[model samples]
Target: MPASISMDENMGFQYGVSRPGLNPPIQFGNGFYGAGSGLIRGGLGAYGKKICGSSSQYVQSNISKYFSDPQYYFQVNSHYVGNKLKIILFPFLHRGHWTRMTEPVGGRLSYNPPITDIHAPDLYIPFMTFATYLVLAGISLGLSGKFSPEAINWQFVKGMVGWLLQVMLLKASLSSLGGGEAPLLDMIAYTGYTFTGLCVAVLGRITLSYAYYLIIIWTSMCSGIFLAKTIKITLYAEINSYDANMHHYLLLAFPRNSNPKPRDSQNRRETISLIQKCKQFHQVPPIHAKIIRYFQVQDPFVVFELLRLCSNLNSIDHATKIFQQIQTPNVYLYTALINGFVSTGFCLDAIRVYCRMDNESVSPDNYAVTSVLKACGFGLALEEGRGVHAQVLKLGLSSNRSVRMKLLNLYGKCGEFEHARRVFDEMPDRDVVASTVMITSFADYGLIEEAIGVFNRARSKDTVC
Candidate 1:
């Protein structure tokens, strides 16, 4: 008989294989197992269960936040539809406020429903307008004696293509101009407003074909004006909060449509406040002369903020001078300076800063490591990347996800897939993102089968993978 096994109440098992001799009594229980085929299935099953349970929980928590609930976009009423249509067709005539209404709920400000807020976006009008366009197109075709199922299908396809182009153009424009974090569905709704104008233009063509050109142009202008106003309002709502001084400065520097006229006393006060804020600064070195002179600021954190701003403005030289004024910089300051260099396409300068931080005996954190690794990847500095990898190991940051991902990215960009694979394999829990990265690396290098193999071996797969 096989060795008698005693199962404890706590799921532990004691094997009586060691009967005074052979192999010093094999033991298989409490998460430790001796070499044996009998316990293989049970151990594998237990491990698989733990992994799947954790993976399921993790995916549920993370993925849910990414995809928005569509129900919010569809909550509409007839009054909203009427008001929304008017705004789309005649936006300039709109006398009401453009700001979205909000209400307090659960200690946070939540936007009011579309039924009550005229400025709020909804899918109801878009869907109705799209259907009306399709119907009108069918009628126009029938009137022209060219009506066919295929023609309707083609018109539908055309309309969809136009809608997609609108969305893509709007999204791309927002990305280029920055500060438009409108939801994907909101973009869809905004773009879909074009269909409302299209419906009227199509109706005009069906009724009075001779005046089609005039009608189309008029509708186009109206649509353009409406969209400009709507998108401007949307962008304005997405502005992040800033300190009062920064807010006043921005208003004075770049007045908006809603900015109070400079003739008003209140507006004058705001301008004066901004000037006073600027007057607080003392004259510094010519290198850090421009904005730094206006803000008499010596705090390293403030300098870091200005450094980021200068980088955004493509004034890296000014940022460097400001950085030099700091007597001692922390990891955040170092990371900011490195990031500024990286953003401004000065990868070598970023690497030098990282090295300088190291030379100063300041222990670099994961953020600094990731920033330099990005510089290495962009500059294709394999040797420098390897040195950073060594530092990562020494600093015990090899286990950090961001650090590892950056290292993997650095190696892959430098055509060092072998090292990338080694880094990938060392990860204890390879999530979808890590697997996707490995697969992408393999595919990029023409290793098709290797990419498929990595995908197949992934314990958890998601749409992203």
Candidate 2:
């Protein structure tokens, strides 16, 4: 017999009496026995009765039973009781219980209920990996500060506040959904912890002041990682659904009606037509060859199209080769390359492209400047960002809204609130962007009241609500 069965039997006899008042005495055969045999049998019997009959045992069994066949206990107090306790005590640990309780009640409980797999490598690994990256970022930023003091600004604090708000929003949304049992406090704590790690990384990358940038970097990194993961999971689920396939095809066929002239209309039409034709005809030219033929004219737009297509196909080398072959690459061409590099998380490469533009004496335009600034942000190149800022001032581009906004953002990111404020004050007109930058700065410094005041003032103005 199985050990559990044997133990149960032994327990059944030792605690044979069903009621507390009743007692059943037994006499064992007189024989040489092992040490403590009577004690062992007695203990086993007592445990069996407790497991099988005690009020606590009954409650546990009922709870598990109700969970297995929820309809049987749909109106039972035990279900609610168990769920309430789980929510209060285990929070994040009992996500499934909360999910099940929230599901529509009429049908038989799902055999394989939808549950988020928390142990998936992607869920936790990226946060940890990015934590290391954050440390590096902090180091890099710290080093960059030696040359670029202006890189540190108030916007970093504001960005940090925005990040914190996002985290709170996410947690609230999750709790509102099926995550009532999710320990929100713990989630917030972990997020803060992760954020700190990232801030350290950013500090290591560039230096303005360790204290403020550290917080901003930490929060930004953690929040960014969490949001990215959540979005990816949601997208994966949506894309994997049967309905999504039909919708995807429909979207491709009809396309959105936003752009006046869809930028890639011809290419899209061809790609879609090619897919449909492939279904009917087995033999067709490779997609690349077709694309090459389609763009035979060598127009800058065509080159851009080919570059975009190649990058989408993960043929970066091919995209680079085509980019190099252009006789006279314009600012747009360089912007495309820079954007492509940034998209691929190659901040260093993007910076190099900006440097090349400088060497060629091609006065980097607004778009180019924006892209390079983004690179500086990513690489934590405070000095480079300051240099760019100086150039913007020299070129009288400081008045340009986009350039000024970027400068505000760059300064804030580097943890220089005063400089960020200076930029904000220098704006020709106080727009929503400028106000938001100021509000964010206050929030980053944990001056919630001040941030709210700014927001209220902006709302009262009603200029750009």
lDDT of 1 at 294: 39
Give the residue spans of candidate 1 off by over 4 A. 1-68, 105-107, 239-465
TM-score for each of the candidates: 0.42, 0.37
Q: Which candidate is the best by lDDT?
A: 1
RMSD of 2: 37.0
lDDT (0 to 1) per candidate? 0.64, 0.48
In candidate 2, position 326 carries an lDDT of 61
Q: C-alpha displacement of 69 in model 2, angstroms? A: 40
Q: Compared with the true structure, what per-residue lDDT tens digits does model 1 show for residues 410-431? A: 7776568899999988887678
lDDT by residue (69-164, candidate 2, tens digit) is 333322324343344323322334434311111111111111122122221112122234344454454446566563233433333454457547
